[model samples]
Target: MNPLLCGLAANPALPPELVDRLLTLALEEARADPASQFADDLLHGLADRADLRHDQILELAAHSDTMARYLAYGGTLDAADVDPGSMPNAAVALLDERRGNLAWARFLATHPDPQIRWKLASCPGLPQDAVDLLAADPDEEVVKELALWTDSPVTARLALHPDPEVRIAAAANPSTPLEAVIVLAADPELTLKWTLSERTDLPQALYARLAADPHAGVRATYASNPGIGQELIRVLAADPELQVRRAVAKHPRIPLDLLAELVVGDRAGWNLLPRIAAATPAELKEPAGSRHAAVRMLVAQRRDLPPHLREALAVDPDASVVRAVAPHPGLSEELLRAMVARHGVQVLAAVAANPDASGPLLEYLTQHRPGVRRVLKEVAEHPHATGPALLACLADRTSRPLAAAHPALPPEAITELLADEDHQVAEAAAGNPSLPRAVMLELMP
Candidate 1:
């Protein structure tokens, strides 16, 4: 099919009469040359569109094309009255629909090919009779596939399968009986224990056992579980493994007091303070007073920091803290402008990217730092950027793609951009609403 016709067929807003005309043309082409793949493809593509009127879908469904009829029936063998036994492709499509047709599912369950049964095994809506038959299939892969489903009638039996891989898949299914879960939890296979450790819905005793697992990896995964209790968090916080402790530090439920204790050292403070969700005024003071520049820099990155802390960090002796807080929206305009005047490129780029930077500040930053990509792209895309700054950005290769889409670009600049060497630049220019209506129609495919 021509790209234009394909685009039109996919457009839901295409008037019904136009769709009818396209379908009529395609069918006429198919009749004259039965081997015409484009006509067949167009017919097949339109068969599954839910937006098509019933009459249009009927035309596709009644066509001689088997694939079109198959697609129209929504992948149901019985719905199309195509022989269920005749086509392996039909069976694959039918299984995908997961229509939960018991007879067809049962028929496919024992089909000579194990691959069909393997596909059937993963269907979430498989009937119990089909599940029962497939679960006992001699083909290990089919049984292994069936073991993945929580609703599989035979999950209990599959849990004890001789293959640990099969048992591991069964362990992931919540419906696997508790006795089997306990067995898998203690099983020598570390992967099975690791998988089971991540599931919080398991009984607390099982979680506790997994938390104390000899392997630190299993304990870390358990520590990160959202549903683990405060008591477990406390235990994990003291664990000798730094990863286990780090996981506790990041847990959403980690107590503020525990977090305070964890940040006693400079290394811990640098890693943990920025992640604390809540902090008291006293907690803020400790980090603010820390001797290490890195510790203070971490505190400066906190979004919930108080205005006083922000103001103090904006002028911090260390350049890192100052740069960290430059983009903070809470900084006063006067303070921001002072930083702009005093600081170099890093601070200038940060200020330009700040959402609260005023239009005048952005325009000045854009004109001064047009070569700095951070400033150019940020200012070009900023809603507050003026026509002159956008036009400057359009002149630079680094920012042209973003600048082309800016509504401030004059009609002539946008038109020039519409044919720029970069396809993305041209595409962005084509979408600019500032493009004259006459120019827009001329660029249409």
Candidate 2:
């Protein structure tokens, strides 16, 4: 009988003679017929035994390592009829490559071999019952892997784990149940709260509570929050670590009223601002031109910067501050123009959309071509320019009605805008200032 014909033979099951045929096919395949060694014939012969008793299947498993290995390698275990006798050992191999059935996997999920259990935890159809059973596995490696796999909804169940490492492991899962993680954040164990607070989406309320946690590490997370609550911030400010203190100093949300206090020291613990020649409001108006670029850069980003602060930045030693002021909403046209003239196109592009920008700024955009309708709107908003000048820009075919229904545009400015040919521009104008009287007459047609 052709060996290839063995699969469709009268006795399809692993009839004893079929093994001898498969072995012969393997030899024929070895000489250079790579296709003959294919496990299909062997797998078919093994799988054909639908009536094999569970013990008989396991007995077959013990008798021939070659057959067991073939079944494990091919991932075609149906012929085994029942879980193989060496299921745990077979599982260790298939689970590694992600190629086994749920029954094969669950058999060794609690197997004495840590390697076997770890691999099973990662199996795609790992049963929840298996997960629940292994939750108490002594190996931290096993516990940690399970934690990563257990979706957050189920992570809460593991929180009661007596091991702090396990609880913290559960906390590290991005999907850890919010309630469970939140409760863990207040856990008396310093490690638990400290670990939980590092998660960015943890509720602000929970973070604030951790800000004053007895453990310094727990408080570190709050220190890093640029937008920490003012009350929580006060607690972090008192933290002993200089690094934590620096984080507080750099936080964008700290009120200018408090920024004054950070003026004293540098990252090196020495007065670093002397180089920049600027200081927080308490020590000085702004950083000196030759001062630390970081301090000045930080000042440039400060939303609290007032007119005086901007003026101070106008001649800032580093072009960064002046560049920052070029786009600053708070700066006057006079100040913005000075910065743009000093720094050129890049800074000009940043605030090109400010409605308060001047005609000169609009004029600059024309020179640069980098200025789109976005820049024109800034010119329209500049306090010095007449409404007519801004209205003419609405005539821009490039980008019509830069700021539609913008509250800052005057009623007359809005009225004339209605005649704009561009539909979007005309719509913006029609919706503006109760519609232009001129438009009302024109639309009558």
Candidate 3:
């Protein structure tokens, strides 16, 4: 057998007729010279393939070689006469296929190795006796694995198990009995409520109970459930806990009025505007001009604001609103220049990072704000940054790392940065992707 034939046999693009010819030649060569390593290698390569025809696999299984039979079986024992002991791989393969006689399942269920028994426990549709044996296995993990199976006949028993982890897995299984759902719903374990709240199939009584669960985590989790009706949303929206209200505000079905109401009076709290799906311009106009800077900050974060609104928010008296609107794509060139002039250091970095900021605006920042290292760093990293601005950033130590990663950096500059004392600078230069092929070759170990 040609040693090169081993690789040719495994090529997926090889025609079926050629593959068959190669297999026949390998078999003939193997039988003629049993100790030929090249023959054995070809046979092993053919036998290990998943795409082989059923007839080809059977041919390999009938051969005298043991590993060839193991690979041909491909983790399935559909063959009528498999001697597992003679083919050691069959022992693990049997459970992977989940196909075997009741006797085999019984034997594996009681195997001394907990890992073996654990694997058997997760197999779907196991015989009742085997399931019973695994349910009583000494290893908690084996029992937990059994609990995770939705079709497990012993779900009711596993749900009431002493260990909370086992019960949690059982509760997560959708096939768990309704009676078990009631028990786990009221289970003192706080974590169980958190898990049960995410389940949409639970009875309404359980949903109601979870909505008002004493623990804020449970209420918050329940509030986020999509199946919860508008009434529950209303209930959670009024809950004393801020986190629960926040979760309710995020529901896609939440009433626009309710979402608009939640956005108010949260001065230092979360920005609910972006997360609220139904927040329209009409709904937000009032909050956009509210006395509270926090509410205005949320409005500024919205990307849908009209040009006038974006311009108004860009120059908001509050620094928070200015910061939020600086990166917004809607701001005009004149507005961007005005923002940079009005709020020099405060908004410079944010303006530099804006994707919509023009190349000339970036150059202006590079020329006028040369002393602001953070602004220079943001400009160096900005995709819209001009070539001259990038070169200027390359000269500044603070901006050099980001400048090295910029595609506009000259090849000579990138190559020199590769050997800089700072490894970060060298790494950034190497990752530029457009580095000359010669430079990349030098980087190879």
Best by TM-score: 1
TM-scores across all candidates?
0.58, 0.36, 0.58
Question: Residues 238-297, candidate 2, lDDT per residue (tens digit)?
Answer: 678766666665554665445445543453322322212334564344343325554565
Q: Rank order by TM-score, top first?
A: 1, 3, 2
Worst 10 residues of 3 by lDDT: 84-93
Candidate 1, run of 10 with poorest lDDT: 75-84
After TM-score superposition, the amount by which residue 414's alpha carbon in candidate 3 deviates from its true location, in angstroms, is 1.2
Off by over 4 Å in 2: 1-223, 226-280, 283-294, 303-309, 327-335, 349-373, 380-392, 395-399, 403-423, 441-445
Q: What is the C-alpha lDDT of each candidate?
A: 0.70, 0.55, 0.73
For residues 1-445, could you state the per-residue lDDT of candidate 1 as single tens digits?
1433443444344456666777887788788888987687657655545567656655664565366337524742243443457554455455556543346788888889887788778777777888888878889888878887637648889888888778887887766787877777778863665767545577777777779988887788888776688888899899999878877767766775576566556264343343454566677787676776765776777766788888888887776667777778877778878776677665777777767887778778876642476788888888777778788777668788788877777879887876577766776676565766566445333
Q: Write the number of the candidate with greater lDDT, choosing between 1 and 3.
A: 3
Candidate 2: minimum summed lDDT over ten consecutive residues — where?
A: 1-10
Q: lDDT winner between 2 and 3, please give it.
A: 3
TM-score pick, better of 2 and 3: 3
Number of backbone collisions per candidate: 0, 16, 0
* Cα misplacement distance, residue 180 of candidate 1 (Å): 5.0
- In model 1, the Cα lDDT at residue 136 comes to 86
